[model samples]
Target: QDEVVGLAGELRSYLSLSLPEHMVPAAFVVLDALPLTPNGKVDRRALPAPADEAYARGVEEAPVGEIETLLAGLWSDLLGVERIGRRDSFFTLGGHSLLAVRLISRIRQELGIELTLAKLFAQPVLFDMAGVIAELVEKSGRQLLPAIEPVDRGGVLPLSFAQQRLWFLGQLDGMSASYHIPLALNLRGPLHRAALIRSLDTLWERHEGLRSVFVAQGGEPHVELLAAETGFGLVEHDLRGVDQAQTRLTELCREASDAPFDFARGPLVRGQLIRLGDEEHVLTLTQHHIISDGWSIEVFLRELRTLYGAFLRDGEDPLPALQIQYPDYAVWQREWISGERQALQARYWSSELADAPALLALPTDRSRPAQQSFAGAHVDIWLDPELSRQLKVLSLRYGTTLFMTILAAWASLLSRLSGQEDIVIGTPVANRARTEVEGLIGFFVNTLALRVDLSESQDLETLLAQVRSKVVSGQDHQDLPFEQVVEIVQPARRLDHTPLFQVMFSWENEDVVAATKLDGLSVTPLETNYEVAKFDLDLALREAGDEIIGVLVYSSALFDEST
Candidate 1:
């Protein structure tokens, strides 16, 4: 418990560097040990809640009017809580941007009043929120509202180490496909090879993370950035496989995606827009996650519709000049996470993992080997809509969100299957909250090391709260990239110690690249011929409006697809 005090202090110091005064955790609850799921990691849900009650104390005045009563109920319902006193903070109750979006829509549809996600964040509590709603309703004589508009956050930001790697890897795939589209393109309008080349050059010149490379300097890998000339060739080939042109493009993009995309690489990211067939094409755009995020990709895709539309209309000149390159954002990010800024992060990462040696014990088909090899398989479990609704309602009732509910359910599933007390899982965080980094389509994806303990039996209500806290706290410490922690902590990366987690579990809501139906091509995701990695198994959980599906990817060399 004393150690928890120290850890909290450290976190407070680190938080001071970047977070506002109001956002730091006000309480810290420590225990003899954190619990784990079958996969063996800290079980946040199991972390004992502070016995002392706090944050529940509310304003003296109660809901004032009919609208206020209605608004408070809406907040409580959307947030999945029994009660939401006017002063209670929405953020403290697991309200994220996605939730905010949903909240706004509900208020509009139910209340016949309008609200913006930004407004909710700015005035995060029910009291303030009620006032905002009251004013809106008063201003508009009729029960009407404006349509929600999308916001574009712009700026260059630093890439986490994993993001750096994914960037280069995406590029390697780009090189193999003439740095743009796919074979289907050649089968169709047959876009000019020269035109594609021109686009990559333009894109690479505009983004800095692109031309970066990794080199061994003085026996250590270092970033060696290249001043890529704003010129590259785009080669189109026949739908027939194995051509010199396709081979070369494939090699470059895939290799680049696999390599280190760092500061050395200026802000030039590349991808191909290959026309695979008559109207179908594969758009392989690879940028270091440094400049982009999942949300950014959505923006890029939408913008691309505009750019390609322009190009198709012979209006190639409409593209805007970038305000700043990725490097500029990178420099700013580094400053935001100075020494003091990282202290609390360091505490959280080290505390739960201190000298702890264990495995979450996922069911593996292969015998335990001396060396750690990344080879695995994938299994998808889709939850039907009715169950999905149950999960959603349960999250709210537990003062949590669907994300936490899913995690608890997944941890529960893993425990039932593997019978491990400590479970470790990997989840991805879509880091796109800031108003500055929205438009840049790059990778800002991160793999979160989630620890769940399924030791004692917990009812659904308690379990949801536990899972909720874990996720919220995890988000607080997300700035520390996974790779950086691996190097510093020296976790069991090998099978014997298995310092780091191998089984990954992700929950997302993104539509397939081309959700809408299109003609002339199947446009399916093809499994590439990549080797099993040192770390195997990634399970992605996703939801669309009301549907939930889980997709698992593993190493083919080690595990059977059916298993």
Candidate 2:
């Protein structure tokens, strides 16, 4: 046992040098001999599972003190791990933004102390979080309060700032399906179709955002929540015995995604279930961008899985009552983004983007089209592990984040490609700074036009510093709506290009590996080709484990594959 433990410890140390904390396995098991099948292939089912206490570093010290013990237990439960050490990092054990929200809520409930997601992000390890919790407990005694149920302000609500922008765009081009957000999942195993439908119905009932529609009232746009009794437009197609199941599934997905929603009469959200086989199915969900954002998708998926399981198990809704709804948030935003606060935000953004350029002037393969065509294609690039690691190290050294580092690199690339020193890139912020709106599913994303001037030909380190400073300042004033900023700056709007910035950049820090497991079913995300582009060139970078995966989305009308 001692020798095995020693070898495991050595292996862990070696892995630590190259692997990220999360990629390194929490536990390692050693087998003396392989269990093979008749074909001499290793029988995975016959392999012994690691012991509950087994960890990559061999024996781990148990959680010490009352706070540590409590936190360890909660972390273990949330992460679905049998044991968690004091030093174990929450994210390293597969905790993400959504799971973090749940963990923090549970902590608040149990400890009677309110904590923010930022707190968990700052202190991710079990030992550190416990220390923070202990300090809070010492300073302020436990004060538990019951959650207030959301009052259904039954009536038409004003469109949110983001929603208003989308509405205006839809008015300009109602037939365009560029604003659609489509997600498909491939499921294998036994799927109860009736229970799944029930869960989806429950979702539409609980969240009004899914059933919302925009109607003009007195020459102004207003939002109306459709009746809860309204059905979620779900259609199923069986291609069980089809010669080309994969081809048929692709056609179905494209048709669903390309279909436009009537914003005036929604069911803005729709679903399609394509049966590839008796046990294989493809589930596709399509929603307009006006009603949903990236964060809302995570909330939707998490809730769907929970509600489906509950329905299948006991035919009861296991989810808690929502504290607030999307309408409430819209009401609050209207009231909040006015008067002194609104003026302050306006002043900050106007000053920050005072002398920014109107366009990036990226070289194109073809002449600019008379009217913008949202057709686009994506090129993916994967950064080597060594480069990814160095980027992290550089970010730490410069007191910046991986996001800032990648943005800097992107700006540099654009500078090289365009031969322009001044670069402006649009990036989306989650805009869920308030705790009250965290759980609500709505369009809360706001785009910020980040302008960086590289005219001085500064070194990469200096440019990173500049980027970090601008990012911090921008985040501080992010509450100001992007539409308001555009109005303030009064950028020349052209049908051929997006105003303020044509190129955009986004970073996905969270692990969004879409995988769900229910009773006898395994769900995974399906890659779909929906050719629609919002900007001239939008770059999305995802930090997965130790590697950085980048996707450059460019307008196909302007650039070809070679470019």
Q: Could you say which candidate leads in lDDT?
A: 2
Best by TM-score: 2
Query: How far off is residue 41 in model 1, in Å?
Result: 43
**What are the per-model C-alpha RMSD values against the true structure?**
15.6, 7.1
lDDT of 1 by residue, 60-142 (tens): 44567786677667667766766555555676665664566556656776667657554665576677888888788789744
lDDT of 2 by residue, 1-563 (tens): 76775464467668868965545555678778999989999875687777653465223557899888888888878788776777677865667544665677678778888666566766777888998998899899787744434545666678889999999988889747899988888889989998898988889988888888999977798888888886665799999888887888899999889888988877789999999888999999998999999889888888888888888876789888877888777877877688997898889888878877877888899988988889999999799877997886676556456788888988988988889998989998888766566776789999888888787669877898788777766765677889999999888888888888999998875545365555668888898776688899998988776689878898999999789
lDDT score, candidate 2, position 200: 89
What does candidate 2 score on TM?
A: 0.76
Q: Provide the overall lDDT of each model, using Cα atoms, as 2-decimal numbers.
A: 0.56, 0.80
TM-score of 1: 0.61
Misplaced by over 4 Å in model 2 are: 1-152, 243-245, 511-513
